[model samples]
Every structure is written in structure tokens, then in C-alpha cells.
Target: MDCRRLGEAGPVVSRVAFGNSLTAGNQLADDSAVACVRAALEAGITTFDTADVYSDGRAEEVLGAALSTVPRDRVVICTKVGRGAGGGAGGLAPERIRSCLDASLKRLGTDYLDLYQAHLYDDATPLEETMRGFAEAVAAGKVRAVGVSEWAADELAEGARLAREMGVPLVSNQPQYNMLWRVIEREVIPACEPLGIGQVVWSPLAGGVLSGKYRPGAALPEGSRAVAAKGGDNSLRRWKFLQDDTLERVQRLRPLAAEAGLTLPQLALAWTLHHPTVTSAVIGASSPAQIAGNLKALDVALEPDLLVAVDEVLADSVVRDPDLTLSRMLRRPRQA
Candidate 1:
């Protein structure tokens, strides 16, 4: 697989980072999750992303166990902290940040994280306080670089300015970006471009909707995320990615993928990497083969005309309003 520097100040990472958010102890069995992580390593993926709240923190345990077999220096481990750190304390308050960082370190079985991100901005905490907490982690050698996820364009600029003042290397921002989801392009990308912060995008395949597996007229596939995630945060009904119009538009891209000598999922994954500001596309997998299949995206280069064609096909089906990029966590009360 290809590699890219995460940002001007961050470590170089694989073009495709493995995301343990969904599969770790949630979608896949322990042994199976371990095997999938090992498969990512075998496929040359060196960056692994997880979060403390994923699967109630079991994701970190599963990912840590999988990475223990390899030399620590060989991989770039990235994880986020923001939600509650347990015991009812959460948000990006200085104390909460410190406590969550320590707990994440313990769960991941690592002394320091290569990339430590605020999973979501804390509306209740002062931005300086949050950046100060991350700055302290860097000073204490508990984290290599600081980053944020799902922050708005203005939030990123303000945070980046604060981090610079605090001597913190604010590097990357994690956001949901895919062929059909263009919310970040309107403001977030332009805001981060000059600041030297690159994007580590999630849901590149739009939660598998871009993979062309969800047919317009067919019943929801058995055991699919849409089926398994029913009535929850990831439920298909909540996200509306399974709508027939969207699926039909996604299906139109099949021939384009064929022409590019790639699978539908490969086309979806490759489309995300086409952006120069994208550091890596995070791929979450339920099996080893899934990781292996996505690795091919690093090699499939989409022509400019093909990209335009994609835009034309998905036209109105795309979601580009920057207002939609705000974090749902903004509604949560302040953490004590």
C-alpha cells in the first residue's frame, strides 16, 4: 500500500488506515477481529484508528491485543477521546481530557499514542482549555501529536490557532467524507488547507452504501450494517443512505468501476483518496478479505473525467451542506 504524511507535523501513515470502531468486539468475534487486524498489517496498513467509547472500550483491547504481536514503532496508533471517560465525567475539559488520555493509554496498552484526537469538540469547555489539555499531554510524552474529529471549519481554525500558541502540533481532522457525502468540502477542507492539517476521512464507502451492495428494490441484505444496526445510531433509517434513489445512483457507478478495473467498493474508496488534502481513508472491516479488498484502492487512480462523471451521476443525491457537519455530541450536557 502507499503511504502519506498525516500532516505537516504528524507521522507518515499508510494511505488506508484500519478503523477498529465497528468491527472490534462488536461486528466481529475476538479472534476474527484479531485476524482482520493482522490482515491489514499483512496488506501493508500501518495506521490503526480506534476510540475509547467504541464497543464500550473493548475495541481498544481487541486492537491492542492484535498490535502487540508487532513492534510498537512499526505502526502509527491513532485513537480519540472526548465523550465521557466513564463515571459520568466527559467532554474536553482539561481534567476529562487528561483522565481519558490515561485510560485510553491503558486500554490500548501503549505508553503514547501517535495521534490523539478530540472525538468531538466540547461546546461547554473553553477551546483554550481543551487545547491546553492536549498540549500538556504532548509535554508529558503521552501523545505524539494532537488532532480533532467532527469539528467545524471555524472551530478548526480557532483550535489550530490555540494549539499553535500552546506549542502543540495540531495535525489532522477526522471527518465523514465519501462520494455521496461532501459536507466537509464546503468549509472544513478550505479551513484546514493553509493550517497544514490533513484529513483522515471515515465512512469513505458511506457505510457500505457506496459499495453497491444495497440494491434499490431488494430487501436489506441479511446481516448487513443496515440490518444489524437497526434502531441505533448507525441504523439505515437514521442515516438515509439506503434510500432507493441513492442506491440507484450508486448502482450507475458500477460500469465506471468496471472500466477502471476496480470493484465498486474500490471505486468508492479510491474516490476519497483522490483529494490531495486527504491523508488517509479509514477502512473498517469485519473480515480479513475486506481489508485486502480495500487495499487495492491505493493503486487505482481515477481519471479526472471519471470523477466528473461520478459527480454528474450522484448530482442531487449528494449531501454538501456544511451545516450538516456539526457533531451531534454538541447537544450533550457539560461533563463534570
Candidate 2:
């Protein structure tokens, strides 16, 4: 439950953020979802992250209900925009940004968001327009800070410039980062560090691949993410870490975890937080125990030698290409 500043000028939040992606979309029962949120709060997790597009906005409703009993100032609620309502269309257009923020606030039963992020970079909408929209949100007291997720290094630099011009504190960049996924380290971190933007990293455990629950040659665990993928949840499939080759490398890390008195998930999460640029690691869970276990990483800090050992073991298995930072949307041209 250690606290860290969201960025150079943002509010301090818990080192580990409770994520609602799983709790949304009927992925977990409503009671279980509520219990998980309650557990996180009991454990002193002050930050909760969700997106409007998650479970078609059902996730925000669940999170809102869970947080209703807590004092609003005691928590930092972070949600996103630009994924669009359903799949129709979404961008950083001022209108869409304003609409999404209002809808998210209504669903979350909150008057203001501690942090409102763009789910991804909108190549279609001018960055200046998006910054102005966020600026307006801040001026109106609807949002305290602005952030973006999965944006490339160049895009982040440009966004930071516009945000400064608009008098908005662009505080965070939510990107995928973990022991096995190091793409953000090369360029994104460097770009953000100077801008005073910290990272709120997602998928810190690589969709449970770093949990060592998925054996390399054995059958997928009965209730693992791989099993969920087989049941038509293709979200985890995009990460190549699920492949046998990567799983084998993960298996090799078990010895290291044992030596450090850490679970695979803790080891993975700790590695992500080791970076100074990382403000928080977002973790999703289906049960209270899962949330409790992941929170242990906040107390476990790896030594310098152990950190090096991790890289040595994961050498060549890590995904480090800067080009990989681009989302599928960023890779393609906006249709006319």
C-alpha cells in the first residue's frame, strides 16, 4: 500500500492500482467483484482504474457501487475515454472527450475524476483539440489530471507539449509493462521522464503468464487466463508470452522467485515497479485472495543483482522493439 505521486504535479496514489477489467463483462460475479474492491480498499489500495469501454461501461457501474461507501477523497479513481461507446467511433475530438467524461462520471457516481486518460492516441483528431478538451475538463473541475495509454514515444512528446500549452498537467501514460514486455523501457520512458509524466503500467504480470500457473508443456490450468481465452476471451492471446517458448522462460524464473521468497506474480510485479518512471502497476483479480497476493509485491523490492539476474534469464525472450509500442490503430492509416 505504498504511495507514489501520479506524476510531477498529480496527486499521490497507491503503488498498486486495483483494475476492474475482469470484474466487468460478467467475467466475475457481481458479489465477487464487490468483494474484490472491498478487499483492495481494506488493504489500503487507494487507486482504482477502469475504462468506459470496459464491459460496455458495466465495469464503471460496478466500481462506482463498490466505492460509494468510501470517502471520495480517500481514493483516486482513474478512467479512460476514446475507445468510443460500443465500437462505433471514438477519438480525442473535444465533443467525444467531453461526452465520455460526463458519462464516466455518471456511471462511477462521482463528481470528478482524479485522473482521466485517453485510452489510446487518436491519430484522427488533432492533439491540440484533445488537449483543449482535457483542459476544459480540468477547468470545470470535472477532471484533476490528464493521461494517455499505449501511446508511442513521439506521440507522447507531442501530447506533453500540447498539454503544457493548454495549461493541463499531463500526468501519466498507461502502457503495458512487465518482466517479459520491455518495449516501453527503450523509448517511452525516456520520452516521458523529462516531461514529468509517470507511468501507470497495465498487464504487469503479462496476463498471468508471469504467475507460473501456466506450465510450458502441461495442460492449461482449469481457471487460468489461457482457459478463459479458449472460452472466447481472445484478449490474452495478443501477448506472445502465452506461447510455449516464452512460457518455458517463465518457468525458469520459478527458482529465482523461490530464492526471493516471492510468488511469480510478485516477482513480475516488483520488476515493473523497479523502474523509477513507473508510478503504479495495475492488477486485476477475480477473488480477494488474488488481490491480497498481488499486493504483497508492493513490499518486496528486488536487489540490484536480482534485477540483473531477471534480465539474464529473460534475455532474448523479452519483446523490446520500439515499433511494438504502436497500437494496431496507430499502425494503420485513418480511413477517409
**Tens-digit lDDT track for model 1 on 20-93?**
77677777789988999899999999999999988889999999999997999999999998855432334788
- Report RMSD (Å) for each prediction in the order shown: 3.0, 2.4
Tell me which residue pairs clash in candidate 1. Answer: none
lDDT score of model 2? 0.85
lDDT of 2 at 45: 92
Clashes of each: 0, 0
* Residue 231 local lDDT, model 1: 36
In terms of lDDT, which candidate is strongest?
Answer: 1
Candidate 2 lDDT by residue in tens digits, 1-336: 789888899879999999977555556877888999999999899999999988789899999999999999999999999865333344778899888889999999999999999988776777788899999999999999999999998999999998898899899999999988888888899999999999999989988888988777778777665564232236555667767888898999999988999989889998898888888999988679998887788888799889889888888888888777745435565689
Worst 10 residues of 2 by lDDT: 228-237
The 0-to-1 C-alpha lDDT of every candidate, in the order given, reads 0.87, 0.85
